[model samples]
Target: MGYQAFYCCYKTDEVVSPEEACEMDLNIAGDRILELLQGDDDFFGLIDEHDTTLQFIRNGDLIWMEIPIPDQKGSFGKHIPIDEVGPLIAGLPSRIDLNDFSEMRFQSW
Candidate 1:
């Protein structure tokens, strides 16, 4: 059990397919975030030890992310917003191609 959030990129309320919703680059960011959480035990030690899961799903302009934050004794979960996705990626020392992804739908949110 954890904080649940959904991000939709379309103007309509209709559910969209993963492929169609992915036109906004939400999938790319999700993959990168997972990779970061997995590849960096030193940086995200809590995530690695607690087995935190960050899932991303695109349905009709809606990007759903299920982040199951572990309920350890005194631990808490950090929610990453869609706008901050760019800053988070930029903060990384790795060479990731952050094209227009960051600028994709900042206004939508």
Candidate 2:
């Protein structure tokens, strides 16, 4: 059996794995995204229960997400930019956007 990696977007009601979820302490995933957004804490701080969108950008392409904002309600993920990714995990953006590469043949998992 082969494990397949998929690029997925989730809404408020959707469920995700532990690894797929963002960290609350702004250490890992959350911190990475914050750096990409140029340290604009307002973007993350302004979020309320009504804001349910979280955007993820991999590579130079845009990924429109629909996941629920961790502690927020009724809010869905939205569009994020790739330039916001930091060097620590910059490759993740490219990996996630592998599907957009015309020269590469993607195999499931």
Candidate 3:
């Protein structure tokens, strides 16, 4: 499979189920995360580990996560533009299906 990257948000308590988590409006939460990641160490540090197939960041009542898809036939992953993140996030559906965590794919190649 090709490389894919995902960005999502959910409650920090981990009590919320996938159904509830999907109901949290990822569009708004994603925007908050993007905004926070800008020139803010505290918000940036929410995500743990720089090197991994999966990484997560927690801030306040929200948690942000990323999953990178690697190129099966090659050693490198696809490239994604940084500028497209905001619009893609803002355009997310009101309800997201995070059960399998496959619905939100902002970048893949």
Candidate 4:
């Protein structure tokens, strides 16, 4: 079994999940994220079963991402150029997990 996650996109007007109504696949979710990033949507969120959250807030050409560290009191965040997320999107884990996103440069938020 794999870790389950939910794609919460307001721009898409729905949250994609692992069900007949909406299956949760990384590729599809990644595409939705890309769409949200490239479009006028201001927020994109992915939350895993463990309750760890990865959230993004888009502001103009920059995107601010926040990942709440498990077992910690604060969050780790980074401000990235919009184009910089494309590669990271391609390399996302089968499951959307904050730990899997540690390769990026992040600061305590």
**lDDT per model vs. reference:** 0.31, 0.32, 0.36, 0.60
Q: What is the lDDT of residue 38 in candidate 4?
A: 51
Please write out the lDDT profile of model 4 over residues 1-109, one tens digit for every residue: 3234444456566554433123345566566666766544456665555555666767778887778675565677778887766555556664566566575555543
lDDT for each residue of candidate 1 in 8-100, tens digit (9 for 90 to 100): 333332333322322223345434433333221111111111233334433322333333334433322233444444345334332222242
Clashing pairs in 1: 7-63, 9-61, 16-59, 16-60
Sorted on lDDT, best first, the list reads 4, 3, 2, 1
Candidate 2 lDDT by residue in tens digits, 1-109:
1111112222222233433433232234444343343322222221213332233433235433333324433334344454433332323331223233334222221
Q: How does model 2 score by TM-score?
A: 0.25
Q: Which should have the higher lDDT, number 3 or number 4?
A: 4
Report the Cα lDDT for residue 67, model 2: 37
Candidate 3 lDDT tens digits, 36-106: 44431222111112222332344333334444435432222222234444454556443322343554345
Model 3 TM: 0.29
Name the 10 consecutive residues with the lowest summed lDDT in model 2. Answer: 1-10
* TM-score, one value per model: 0.24, 0.25, 0.29, 0.59
- lDDT for predicted candidate 2 compared with the true structure: 0.32
User: Each candidate: how many clashes?
Assistant: 4, 13, 4, 0
Q: Indicate the residue-level lDDT of 73 in model 3.
A: 28
Order of candidates by TM-score, top first?
A: 4, 3, 2, 1
Q: Which ten residues in a row have the lowest lDDT in candidate 4?
A: 16-25
